[model samples]
Target: MTDTTHNEYTLTCRFSSFDTTVDVIFNNTVDTINDCQKKNYEGFISKQDYLVPEILQQVFEYYKKSYPDYYQGWSYGNQLTKQQIEENLPTPTNAMNLKKFIEPLSVYIADNKNCEEGTFGIYFDCTWDIKSSLGVVIKKWKVAEVGTGDIAFLF
Candidate 1:
């Protein structure tokens, strides 16, 4: 059980075997605390509510459906440091083109079918290297993680 109180609202999460129950209390009278609680307790995860990219959310759902035992919770937390991002950036000479840059990678999990309990972590790494017509080179890299419906992007 975890309780968090803020000026705008108060949130309490109760963990259980069936599902997690989240209750919310609003400081303002106009807020519907019960409605908020209902929204939070729903079993399904929503990308719009969490501001997650649809592609990332799809990946999460895929893992959840394919490997229920391995999928614990979805998370969007920063697990990589700036230095790591810089190190993972692609070299200018091997950069991918624009069309290739936005293309999503095929989702890969260490254990596709057999997932253990606790927390399941998914890592995504992307690098873009662009070479201008003049031979100038630019490098970019991004690393992301998904766990328990949470997603984090490291650039």
Candidate 2:
């Protein structure tokens, strides 16, 4: 069941690779979730959901690449380096499923300042442990170079 008050709709969507149907919130300035936009979101989610594996793989890679600098001034100190993370983090022959690290939050369409219309964002809770994510979109995938502790990919 889905309902919308204002431009927000809680949709019962079944995204691929997800074992359970998560209730995702859809919000936008273009069109209401009751229209074709809802279908578009569904399709987008399905198409891009597969990126979870690779995304996870990239997070560790990024952490190992940047290392200590981004993780500086920590209570534990900046002693953690790329080599340290690489040594501990597993690099499986195949991409590992790290979707469980993120919890689907909401979908923002035509509302993102990052891009134009047809652009949307799916925010997640993958906080720095492949954990902090702005959302997964098919657009451009660039992990923060300045170390914002989150990957804000847009599509």
Candidate 3:
């Protein structure tokens, strides 16, 4: 029922040695001015790849300090300060490192099955090593949520 422009992004982190990878799927929707109603199956207006590292860092801080259950996946609803947002401004290097810009179409179509929906934060099921799993989530960011896990495994 929200009109907010739909935004979606996936943050994937990988650890080759452990054979583990984690992805954070973020989707946010709110009301918008346009009357043309469109349904957004996912959340987020767009995936901002440059912020991946910092966002993952934020998640790490949350998990460490809060000791979240992470059963169904923890939910975090915090607004980014103007300063914080500015600091996360996307750049060519960050996006390239994440491989988001390299394969835009593939990244956009990947399924969200690994991602668990949270109040505002995106969560993933961690059946493997917790520390290793979290390590993957800490790396990589994309400007949009469109892409697959192929690039993550490359790291």
Work out the TM-score per prediction: 0.19, 0.49, 0.23
Ten-residue stretch with the least lDDT total in model 3 = 33-42
TM-score of 1: 0.19
Which candidate gets the maximum lDDT versus the true structure?
2
Give the alpha-carbon lDDT of every model: 0.26, 0.46, 0.30
Which candidate order results from sorting by lDDT in descending order? Answer: 2, 3, 1
In candidate 1, which residue ranges exceed 4 Å CA deviation? 1-7, 14-32, 43-155
Better of 2 and 3 by TM-score: 2
lDDT tens string, model 2, 32-102?
44444554465556555555565556644554564454344221555676566444333323335344444
Q: Model 3, 39-138: lDDT tens per residue?
A: 1112322333334454444434434443334321222353655344323222223322322211111112222333322112223332212333322222
* Ranking of models by TM-score: 2, 3, 1
If candidate 1 were superposed on the true structure by all CA atoms, what would the RMSD be?
Answer: 18.8
Model 1, backbone clash pairs (residues 3+ apart or across chains), number = 14
Residues 38-59 of candidate 1: C-alpha lDDT, one tens digit per residue: 3322321231123223333443
How big is the positional error of residue 11 in model 2, measured in Å on the Cα after superposition? 1.5
Write down the RMSD of candidate 3 (Cα, Å).
16.9
